[model samples]
Target chain A: MTAVTLSEARPARLRVDGRLGQFALLVPALALVTIFFALPAIYMLRMSFNAHEGGQSYSEAWTFANYLRLLTEPIYLFSLGKTFLLALVTAAVTVVFAYIFALYLWLQRGWHKLVFLAIALCPLLISEISIIFGWWMFFPNNGVLSITLLQLGLIEDKISLMYTVFAAIVGLTYISLPFGIFILLSIFDGIDRRVLEAASDLGAPPLKTFAEVLFPLTRSGIVVAFSQAFVWTIGTYATPIALGPDSLWTIGLEIYQQMNTWRDWPFASALAMVLILLVLGSMALTRRLTGRDVTHHV
Target chain B: MVWPFSQSDLFRWLHAALVTLIVLFIAVPVAVTAVMSFNDASLIRFPIRAWSLRWYLDFFSSSQWTQALRNSLEIAAYTTLVSTVFGTIAAYAFTRLRFPLKGAFYFLVMLPLFMPGIVLGLGIAIAFGGVELFGLQLYGGKALVVVAHCLWAMPLTFMVMEATFKTFDERLVEAAYDLGGGPVRTFFEVTLPMVSTGVISGALFSFVISLNEFVMALFLTTRDTQTLPVLMWLSLRSAGTPRLAVAAVVLAAAVFLSLVLVMLWYARHVRKLR
Candidate 1:
């Protein structure tokens, strides 16, 4: 194909022009990105340098005070640490559940596939607020699960699962689960079923076959899914805020508080920059783990 | 077939049970939310006093709820249109171009997707605060909300369409050119049709993201133009009412309907591929 391309492909010059023309067609989009996306980000970076005092106008003086505050403040550092922990736990839970669910869907046939599809679609389809409310109902004192447990004598009294770290984790994991399942399902679909049969014929047990053959092939997918889930969970604001206890303020919630309650634009911008860096760092880490540029071994 | 002594069978069954439990865990919250929405009482309590469509009725009748719903729908529509158009164009450019700084430009475009919504909102809000263009304030309006949403939506749409375009056969474009078709003509007649599924799905995804978005909307929207999710958040903080449940149900219904439509579209596309 490479040898055929340069000489005989002279006729394909028209297609090359077609491709170039497609680039011209992108001018509007490029302009939009420049005006809205690039400009805003640049402006934000500039704003981070501006100096602000308590309830005062931002000055033109470039200062590192905001950055210094973020570094020095225990609250900010603590919130950032908590955000990472929550995201890590959420990613782990999502991957475990998604892997098992994807495996079941892959092994099952016919009607079971439809069942899996519906289950997978629920979290993806429902609004985040609704999901929160659902859990809110399930965890509260008079909520369904608590009430049911009490009635069935499974518990001595109503238990409040709401406003707990566990609830926050559950909510984040639930929200992230669908994307994990979808991406992993695509990976699972790419695997050759006969490989498992061959492994069994070679006297390999099912667990051994999974560990040796299937796991290696799906490693990239696992990395990608976990990273995506982690990044999403880290960025999440509503789930953590609504589900988490008052003590559990994430970086996202802190940013909101800074901007809205504190009216501290500079500090908020500093926090935002930190958030952007963390997200990019996580994405880079995921890419490294997955060896994203490498060819699939299978 | 008679593997009675094999541990694999037990493992398989365990896996199946685990999956079933996980599915149930995921579904229970949604089912509970739906049931609570129909509760007759004013508060969101369990072991329901009775069942009624009171919340749904209240949602429609209340100006606050209806207005928020309208704003949410309008913003979602605008965001979808803007993102879909710009994203498809950008996707085309990325997939087809070999321009200088192409990779850098693409990275810049997608950087916003990695930024958290809170950060994006804060940045935009601060960046545009008191900044007037054309004698009009840029912040705290519908226009700003749409633009803010496009930060993520555009990149998402681009990513999806770029993947679609990568799978596109170059030979077909060559064939079109050989038949004396211009690039624009070929794009409309051939390229668009080939990637219609991707475009539609991407647009739908943008719509859903914009519709369900809360964090950014919470920051940007004023009381007059608050989106549904923002209004819900505000209400949830101040008090827990059945009206909130009603809003949840309405939003859920909209999301579910859109999701089903998209899946049906995907099913038809898969059938066509077959």
Candidate 2:
């Protein structure tokens, strides 16, 4: 009877080994990523060098002309500069709001944090397109804000604020704030409260304690958060197109326009290549600044 | 210690005012959309002349809105299933396996998370468009939307689950295995129960992402299979109507509902930990 029981367990052991051996469970994801993500990225990089005209692909004539054009063209260079500026401003605004809100929640005891958390979730859960519509309805001449301001006599008449840089900044900051707060919250949770108390006990002012104690501890987290938000805001297309004025043409919008309207896949691919480089460069800088590898952290 | 009691009241008032202003700033736009959805006017304008559910009624009665909603739901459902399953498996492998190039694999898998959607959508469109596999075209259909969405959803799910798995205790798995359970039995009886919360949250996120995705859906879908966001985009460019507001309200409602569910789940999980 013992022998028979032992023999029965033998197949189970074999089955365990067999299952591990199959490695087939990961095939779907591996295959999907390899095809849809890996291959396409490579193809996009290659296409950036190719020459396409009039919706027709020519031979495999590889050149750096696309990159050259981007450097020489005033519009592309100006848009690149503006995109970086907008991303930087958005990151700064998000960080400030996120830091204050996170500190408030951290200081609070219970349900207050929940309320703030819910508010943070609002922009994150909704579509970017919908958030644009929401802000669009609240900013223009006939929207709620203008109407309210008009009623309260804050302005002479209904004012148009939709197509402004301020609108773009606000929208981007709103959307990116949740991620910043979430990341910083985790970092703040790791900090000990007694450090702040000790500083206070030493007669340090509130601002001094925050600067001298909390800031240094959360420096890496701040860097990570800022870089993440900057990269996201830079690459984002929808909010900028819907909320930004006609004069502001972000690289994202330019890429989209090249593909959809101009049917210039080569130029679009070149623009995408620049975006990819920017993202990679940011990732490298973040890793350097944080003094640790973040790939595993993800 | 200097308590600054003289200025405490002023500080408190300032904090209160700041919080209220920020909350209003965040809430007003959403509130505007919600209120505008009920406007009786065909045009979307402020100072409502009248209030009616006409837009909501129109949204539901109209075939375009209904079909788009249906398509969005179907695509989201499928994308959620595929991403959750694959993501869970990938997460498990990353957490459990001691394979070569593990870090590289993890980075590659998560790379899509940072990639811009426009680039991904364009690449997928060009790669899959007009490509027939055994007499079937994958692009310009719901299948393409599901695939394109997976590019975003899978990475997100993996990242969330990976974080959850890091905090998971491995001794429990060993204990289950030592108790005469096979790997499958151990996983089903021990591991699944442990990570079920993470799985649920991941699924919720994937659902929301697939539903709200616009750029990918715009590129990968046709008129018949266009998701709600794509439909909304087309409609917004073509005309402005209160019915669009109704659709926005509906989308926001769906997102709000899912968020509540996730928060409840998180609350329960916190309680369990306590």
Candidate 3:
């Protein structure tokens, strides 16, 4: 990780005495996370090793059977691939669109900017279930899309677009696009508007200026946005099930099925460990992508 | 891939068209949901045959829906309270006090933000399944849901409040101290008011997050303690009804209410604080 990335989230330092008092004050937050966050995670990791017998709870006969199964199991392995693929596609689409939106936002000094901001931020504020429900009404038979298309004479017959991978992609992209927009907008805010003007002044047209002067500067920032979106998208549990078909299973669904339905805690822990490792790896990649960008902190 | 339309009317027209298209794509589904909430149809289909208050009436009269709503409110209230207090104290430490291992603590505190909700939920469920505290088993209840929510809410609170305190003036604090006011008194009189907007904003965010959060709530709550989002998710998986649409509107309404509160605060308090 680079210092630039850290500085974005870092708190400003204030000089004061009584470091002891400060440490004392931090105890409640520390203890809150330690007991509820750290300890439970450790216990989960430990339970992944506990022996399982197709039971709801495992006994304390430490073994690597769950890990071995997670490695050798075809269902688990395939779900991991499917999850990574969907997440990559979703993140890529989200970042591309968000880049355009962010660029437009950076160029504008009008009410259009407020409209864009308000529209982009709505997804972040609403519940994920609500979003899934919205799209649920959107793609299914006689839903809004079909009704609108039918009324417009765009299609001869009423059609349902539900329970498809396309719906899954749309839902995932919708949820992720806001984060991408915010990240890339932060980068756009750092860019000097004069650079584009200079390119135009040098006899380059708009397309040439954008291609030569804008894309390269924003590429690493897009990488950070993409990585963050990918990491976030892979952890989604309800979107696919609610919007996509049953066959469109991801590892997130697998985790829920194992713990909630199948009652297999040990295997669920193994799956969760893999998930945590993947998220951390992607986060590290995000840090590395922006490591050398001088404009990163800005 | 730059287009050659730079000199043509097509360029500007297409740009405007594309922007409008994306806006509709983002807006239409939500509009459909809000419209469906009022649909009198038996199902969640569009082109409403007629509009009625039937679903809304059904939603209001149902004990299950009311119970879920109450549960959501209580859990969110608890989460907001606990997360805000701890997060504010932690923010003070991070912004105003120097200590060893502060960086490590920061990472540890923020680590849960990235942890998948399922993992967080599963971990707590397993670790605390057998927990006995003061002759009570702390599993599968509103209290567990509150604690689990803190994993997400506390870090959010800390991040926002920490940033807010950086803009706070230390001269005022020094002035209070110079006047012979002690730490607690200074904190209440001088420090608290300066950071009051941050506190309110953080608390509102925590509340909204808890209110809308269903991922961890999925694994944490029992049938009796299930939050509105959790109930909505459960119903969405099984029954795709307009009643669920009504529930979504309710949940979205809660968020909008808080959003209005924040906007009001921004108009009244935030500019003054600056």
Say which candidate scores most in DockQ: 1
Give the Å shift of residue A296 in candidate 3: 11
Q: Candidate 3: which stretches are off by over 4 Å?
A: A1-17, A54-56, A292-298, B1-10, B270-274
TM-score of candidate 3 on Cα atoms, chains taken together: 0.92
Candidate 1 segments exceeding 4 Å error: A1-20, A293-298, B1-7, B178-180, B260-274
List clashing residue pairs in candidate 3: none
Q: Which candidate, 2 or 3, has the higher lDDT?
A: 3
In candidate 1 the C-alpha lDDT for residue A130 amounts to 74
Displacement of residue B159 (Cα, Å) in model 3 is 0.9
Candidate 3 share of real interface contacts: 0.57
TM-score of chain A of each: 0.88, 0.91, 0.89
Candidate 3 lDDT over residue span A1-298, tens digit each: 6876655433222223445566677999999999998898888788888876755467777899998887788887778888889899999989888887777677666696788899888888888888888888889777888888989999999899899989998998888888888888888888887776667567787677768888788877788888877877888888977778887788888988888777788888888888888887887776776673211221
Per-residue lDDT for B1-274 in model 2, tens only? 2222113466556655776776777787688888889899889888998999988889999998899999998999999999998888778767766778877877888888788888888888767776987788888889888988998899888888888888899899777766778777877788877998899888998999999999889888889899889888888777778888889888878777877888898888889878
- lDDT values, one for every candidate: 0.81, 0.81, 0.82
